[model samples]
Target: MTDDTPQTRRPLRVLAAMSGGVDSAVAAARAAEAGHDVTGVHLALSANPQSFRTGARGCCTIEDSRDARRAADVIGIPFYVWDLAERFREDVVEDFVAEYEAGRTPNPCLRCNEKIKFAALLDKALALGFDAVCTGHYAQVILREDGTRELHRASDMAKDQSYVLGVLDERQLAHAMFPLGDTVTTKEEIRAEAERRGLAVAKKPDSHDICFIADGDTQGFLSKRLGRAEGDIVDESGTKVGTHEGAFGFTIGQRKGLRIGTPAADGKPRYVLDISPVTNTVTVGPAAALDVDALTAVKPRWCGTAPSGPGTYTAQLRAHGEETEVSAELVDGALEVTFTTPVRGVAPGQAVVLYQGTRVVGSATIASTRRAVAAV
Candidate 1:
């Protein structure tokens, strides 16, 4: 005779990062409804333990944490707040200031995704014995036939956030869940769902990307952080035309706030060409100089398990920007993207995300940008 005992499959436990927003609230509820043991967690990024920004509708504030807690309670799940201020300051805030000082535009949200969300929080969840980590990011992941994960654009193209998440590698993709990915739910639908559930923040406004920089005073933030350092703004021919508060205040391809009066020799509006931190000068030139067809990026990270062979792809230089068809040639530790048509306003120190169809193949930090000297 043989004795038979029942075997039990453990329930899937998901740790959802709730920012007290409608999207995340709905995401957690959906996960719970799908039979997963869901727990909502909010990250506190404030420097001071009790200090939270005013009208902070996003994550990391007391009000947001309360909202998250209330949503979790309404869903009959547990919730907690994790203090990650030190990590945020070091990884996101410092990197932002340093990149601007070096005359390079920085994507702080991308940095936060790489350093805080997917890296730190993910590790913590794994260590705490959670089966998976979930976020409200508008991106999707697909498992291919070869058992490899692929990152793809969200079905809602207008709300796609694949650009910020392009830096994720195979490992992170394996253990992450984006509940808002498969559905093409607009922001209005999400708010309606939250309201139907009687959850707060249903009508709350969306939060800004750089929440710490109040009033969107990037120049003021840099001035206060790095101290005042004056510089001269010059033209293409190296003629001094105007003065600027700081070199970090301006970025490549900027045409406004140049403070230049005289028209160019061709009588055209002057644009920013180069920012020289060494000489402390902001170079201005005609708009034509900003056109670029070629760009190179370093430390490339691919989302798929494909070989780094040469192939044609589309690339986006900025978040939410149009994707331009391009031919990609992978070199030793770098990717050189050449546009089919002359693409303009390519800047250094931004990310170049390559895509094959809707799937993100890889991404890299822009090393340099240049216009095609010869037509293809």
Candidate 2:
């Protein structure tokens, strides 16, 4: 009779998401350098692989897949391409159109991170027997003493991407790896690293625009996607100022391109205050109307443990933006936040990420906002 005990390996298997950019290429190299058995995966999110435009900013094209594969080769790791165009369209593109039609601005990158990279993609990796999935996001995932995972801002605060990723739950964080978190690597540094390694994506410009909107035709895309519904552009007093092609064309707090020449009595710049999809009207007002103090966010997703009572945290309404000190309360699964200083133009449907110092506590979708009923 013999007794045997098997030992697990120190280095783990990781799947790094490569987007044909220097950041992602460096991420794969860092993963390999960290002693992990890394494999690069590029998500193909366009039906016409050749139609994937890279001159401007976009992702998930055949060319991008090839660049990612080349980077993987340079890093001495295996590579594969996964066709996720259908899922991306359904989860991100359709949702963006729907939200615009509803007169609410949507953050498609946040949706992509939540549904695609961390959810669907993570599931696929787990099924393939990978211990973790890595990305080039400038954010950190810290494991707490109680075995719960927490998200944090990256070392490069200016490049930190924690806002869009705050919606991730603990389960996703447990299997997620952000290779570029601890380093203060600028965009140039990543590219230089890629060039030093002779990676194909060394000089690949980062994707700046939404992947689906290759021509940067947001208005045209919305018109085609949501169907043109004629609307009236009105002033603060509900007086019709001009006509709009559709309600989906405007968003809250937009300042320019109203095309209304009518001069106001006060000679102040008119900004977008509200948009009504039902009446198909875009309401314009003075810039004063954009200021908001309190905001309500629905579907709050806590990072580790859900807040049980009223607490103070820094709240950021926009991604890659500044955080304002605020008091947050967990009320019936929603977060009611009162900014310490008035935050202007906080729009609905934007993500509100709460943080305690450098650690991301939770996040929610902004459902409503107004002047603070009470001071914080």
Candidate 3:
């Protein structure tokens, strides 16, 4: 394995994506400090920047742009704002709504990283002669002796973002730089470093939830986009129990806000077991019904080389979720994964990232799931 230090690498032109957060600002500063020719750029992902709320948890806001510009000024690097609102809306926002409408939960962050950051932005940077596109993502790119690259979790597992970044293919990994990956420091330490470097966003609050949905109300956001179509909330046996304005509002394993008037026969709480967009129905059942033992996924993106056959790996079902042991293999251009034990709440359309130790093996979009035989 190549030395896990950025200092040993030769100076090159780096295009740092400054997200107007403490992490990105500090990352840009570190790149410039290491003698790399770094230029900072903030992605304007909102078409109507004025309409988006400006505050701690909002991303791509005008305030965020200003913060990014200020940080670039402090870092002594040229700053620019790239208007990617149209692309973001088409790729990330619309994709999110579509996934929901199809009765699946989607991770917009993963889509943004895949389509906007890596595909669109990275391509543009490379066209402009930049050798690499750097970001504040808490993940590492390990270069092998053979010159191939591998993506891995950050040293600080608490802040590791490799799950969202699992969509990066080998080509994208070649030109990606993550300066914060190897650091064992806490997020507070990163903020302190930014303060020492005179970066104004040192204490800026981190953005969370869906950036496009400024209000943090996902149900409201989807309703506005897709328009409400009243649907039936039914039990697993197809018995209607309640009604919802939109079936898209529900997701697998959701338990609250179901508005079911009558309790279960056994007086147990009911969890969302499935959603059928075609029939416009949401299926709820006992918590035991949510156990998933196996899943099939499509569109696998390998970080390095694709696995040759079946392998024992750890699979992360969602971002910030715990990794569970799984046996995975590629079959007929799809990924089939079987867990060592039943995992709950494995939903379709979510990316399942596979890892062998700390290194990211690949990721695939879950297509379907199967319950354990015992549970069935």
Candidate 4:
């Protein structure tokens, strides 16, 4: 007799990380429909969890866990909440503070994806015998004939999130599933499906800019965590133009909040061009000073096999920034991304995600930028 019992037959087990949002809800539902034994897991990240999410944007609050449970219930899958507060603090929160204090702008969401979500959660799911960890990320993983999974941008280019998820390596990609990849063409479509399935968070607004900073005051938040270190606001000639409360509060390319009394000799408004953490100095310059000719990056991460050497690729600096054609050459142990056309707002400690067309092939953390020597 053929063995067809639930206890005897092997089933595909997937752990879906639900964030109490419509995307994750629909993603979990889709996973269940795909014949996988799916379990919904909501990660409790905030140390001081709010009883309810403020307004419609805030997330990871107590309300999210309840919403995730309801979605799991509707999908007829098991649901559980995991407390990753300590890990999130160490990996994501502290890292954000440290990066800013070190004179580099950091992306906490990307760090969460790199350290907490994929690394921590994926590790835990694997130990529990789950085949893969599924998320609602707007990126696709295509399993090729060569038995390698390729990470590609979603059909909806506007909503493509491959940039933030650039840290995933080959091992992680092999066991990662993005249910909302190419299937859900738009956010509205995901919401409509959630509503059709009776999921309550269908009409929920997207999460806020920074979830941890509930009040949306990043400077105040950083100032509190990392104590204020008053510094000098200087110009290109090293002349002190003004004074600042804290050096950590400013970022490169920042034009506002400099609090300078007078404009430069050129009569043009100044933009933050450099931040010296050691000297606690914030340097402001004209708008053209922000342009970068090349960027040197470290901690390189290749999606699949590491490329041999120097080659031409699409270099995407910021998350929503335009992809500029560039030539990437590996020198010593770093990746040097040279642009034929100067790029703007190229900050250190930011991710420089490389793309071979729509595929996210590799990534690196920008260590430093080389600007034009001549005046603009």
Candidate 2, residues 219-306, lDDT tens digits: the string is: 9989987788887999978898888899888888888788887877789888888889899999987777777889889999878889
Candidate 4 backbone clash number: 0
lDDT of 4 by residue, 1-376 (tens): 0012232134568899999988888988987887779999999997787922566656789888899999999999999999999999899889999999999999888889899989999999999999878888889877765667678887788888899888899899877878777753677878888999999989988886777877777899899988887789999899999998788898889998899987789899899999999999999998888989899999998889888888888978888888999999888889988998888778898999999999998889999999866473
User: What do the candidate models score in CA lDDT, each in turn?
Assistant: 0.82, 0.83, 0.91, 0.85
- Order of all candidates by lDDT, from best down to worst? 3, 4, 2, 1
* Candidate 1 residue 17 C-alpha distance from true site, Å: 0.5
Tens-digit lDDT string for candidate 3 (99-208): 99999999999999999999999999999999889999999988876778899999999999999999999899988889898889998899899999988888788889
Which one is best on TM-score?
A: 3
Q: Write down the lDDT that model 4 would get.
A: 0.85
Write down the TM-score of every candidate.
0.93, 0.94, 0.97, 0.95
Candidate 3 regions with alpha-carbon error over 4 angstroms: 1-8, 374-376
lDDT for model 3 comes to 0.91
Worst 10 residues of 3 by lDDT: 1-10
Q: After superposition, how far is residue 95 of candidate 3 from its true place, in Å?
A: 0.6
Worst 10 residues of 2 by lDDT: 1-10
Note the residue pairs that clash in candidate 2: none
